[model samples]
Target: MKRFPNQIIRLIIPFVIIIAGLLIAKKFLVPASFGKLGHFRADALGEAMSKPIHYVGQQACADCHDEIVKKKAASYHKGVACEVCHGPGSAHVDSPTENKPPAPRDRGFCPVCHSYNPSRPTGFPQIVTVTHNPGKACISCHNAHDPVPPHAPEQCGACHGDIARTKMASPHVDVPCTVCHETPTEHRMNPRMYVPTIPANREFCGKCHAKDAQSAKEIPRIDMGTHGERYVCWECHYPHLPQVYNGAAK
Candidate 1:
């Protein structure tokens, strides 16, 4: 009593076939346990459990590496698991001599975490691998296990590397770090314990930048009282590379 147009029938035939194909595929392809645990497969948990466990816990690694574990526990990498760098350690734990975990000795490997990514949280240490001691490995200058919290650095750049590198090419390049930062003698050996004091007021920067200052004329001048009177100099101008602001060089 009812019939579709030839064009309508053409579309309907393919649609029906596609639907039938999908139903057939689902019947044979989908796991039987699917939807048993609300969009999850109940068998998936058992399947995963049946697989050989590749990673032994951190405590297992520490059993034979107590000294290294202790050093790492006190360093910047304290939170980083040993397996993260050394690969799955279960085999090594089971057969210590025969199944040694691979050590990532490649210089390229370090940039995975150390690369200068702006999206990283503020104050997280980063470096541009291409320009930062290009010929050398990271472990050359810094020990991987105990990078900062345990090692006593002889220079400020050892800890404040990004700042030091920026300042190296800045107008204040010749200026001693002590000129702007009243660094304690102990700061070099124990940086975190003895934090250095930074410029607190515009007047501190005005020592050299003030229009009426008794300093080199080649240096840029600004009336600290009238220009940016409310803000500290470093608030708008980073002390490391003060000439640049909001991506423009002043």
Candidate 2:
């Protein structure tokens, strides 16, 4: 081959040197175990395993809190693990004397999970905290372990004894007051001036009285097209003691 020109030789020498330098640097710079486990540092697994465990699980918690676990098991909140509210118990489990788990309070505890999110499943109870109870803790009315508050009728009756009596004697005795009125979680916490809305429309009645509903067969069903269009349901029948009357005279 013809001898390379001085300028060309100089350029080629620098390029070869740069490639050799990169190869040498890569040998020292790249981790030895990197790619040994397919793009992950093999030593990282050992590092992670060496770190202390944080969560000890619900079974570990139940060893000392069997009573609480028992109540939780029977309640709607049975699926919620103890550590979800209580935080990680590994430290506490490791040394019960020194590492005590903090007690969960009402500040932002319950609403963290219970607060109204439209994306939550339909059966999950959710509340708009601001509208429900402005400044009250959830524990005031609801049991922390069993969670489900007292029956609506009894709770409503505790304050509205007269209305409760009237409702108990009415045709709608079996129906819950919450059916027509909404008592948000906040209202249950502090019932100061909370006046539940009494819906006075035919469509409200149509929820249970609509002839189209398959489940409403056991209850009175009406044709809203013909029967209840002219007047509100309460216009003809009393809300507490609904009774069918002849003609629109009432």
lDDT of each: 0.83, 0.79
- Candidate of highest lDDT: 1
Clashes of 2: 1
* lDDT (Cα, tens digit) per residue for candidate 1, span 25-129: 999999899998889888989989999998887899888999999999987788899999999998899889998898877798889998999999755678898
Please give the range of 10 consecutive residues that has the lowest summed lDDT in model 2.
Answer: 186-195
What is residue 23's positional error in candidate 1, in angstroms? Answer: 1.6
lDDT, candidate 2, 35-154, per-residue tens: 998888889999999998999788887888899988999886888888888789898888898988887876588888889898986435677888876688787878888887566423
Residue 14 local lDDT, model 2: 91
Q: What is the C-alpha RMSD of each candidate to the true structure, in Å?
A: 7.9, 12.0
- Number of the predicted model whose TM-score against the real structure is largest: 1
Candidate 1 ranges with C-alpha deviation above 4 Å = 1-5, 62-68, 76-153, 156-175, 182-201, 207-250
The TM-scores, one per candidate, come to 0.51, 0.48
